[model samples]
Target: MNTFRAARFALRAKPTASFLGRRTYADAAGPSDKIRLSLTMPHQAIFKGTDVVQVNIPAETGDMGVLANHVPSVEQLRPGLVEIIEEAGSTRQYFVSGGFAVVQPNSQLSVNAVEAYTLDEFSIEAARAQLAESQKIASGQGSEADIAEAKIEVEVLESLIAALK
Candidate 1:
């Protein structure tokens, strides 16, 4: 009977001793330290499990900046710029045609976009011309589906133009 009691006490005490040395949330590493990022599109993978210091995404809820240890969330991205701050402190920007941004619990950010491209890859003149054409169709007496498609194009083009500026 005494041996059974001693064994129980030892097991309970061992757990308490380990728990006492455990670090609290406040004592843990900073959230802005670093995070793994994977930015992908249909045609190419922009970032393949790369470590980045920060990432600013244009989510439907609002523009949000994510860092290491960010709260896990699945956000609907808007057609706008996705800025990635690399480990070397250089910032790279890409215009995404709307998709999703997923922040995992394990300090990982995955952004899957319908289309993404650098600003220099776009021509301002071409965008402006397309914008004009889209606006004309959107406001014209076209079919409902055609008008809706034109409106969507207008929105995306406007975002792209804003990012290029």
Candidate 2:
């Protein structure tokens, strides 16, 4: 009896477009629509369920621009820039070290990053100095672990410099 009930529940039909309260993907992602976006990091939540016109992310596979009602998927982000266009047509740019972004069924995008900061917050001089130091360490005769760490730092600084441009 329990098994039969479980099977029946599993086979239940999904509401169709004609259902009075059902909303289709096309209806939700109509032109000029916005999606809810949440960009979070370990220490801060940049945008918390804020409605935005669009978001551009640097995914491992490739760069992608997300709009409302995009097919649900998970993308691994690379160290690069994330651009957000707000409802009022203002744009903001952030540098994310790396992260995971998930697009949900109801037009919600959640990004979890290890570290992120607005472009304006970064100083070009500081980044250049760091990049130079990292390059020296990476190219010098250092321990394998130190060299590896410096190499990672170099990659991150290069990405930051590109984003600053």
Q: Of the candidates shown, which would achieve the greatest TM-score relative to the real structure?
A: 1
- What local lDDT score does residue 11 receive in model 2, on the 0 to 100 scale? 21
Identify the candidate with maximal lDDT: 1
Model 2 poorest 10 in a row by lDDT: 11-20
Give TM-scores for every candidate, taking all chains together and pairing residue i with residue i: 0.80, 0.79
Clash counts per candidate, in order, are: 0, 0
Task: Give Cα-based local distance difference scores for all models.
Answer: 0.81, 0.80
lDDT: worst 10-residue window of model 1: 18-27
lDDT of 1 by residue, 80-153 (tens): 99999888889999999999999876778899998999899999999999999999999999999999999999
Candidate 2 lDDT over 1-165, as tens digits, reads 685454323322221233223232445532426678999998899999999977889888778777765556799999999999999999998899998999887778898899889988999999999999999999999999999999999998998998888
Q: RMSD of model 1, in Å? A: 12.7
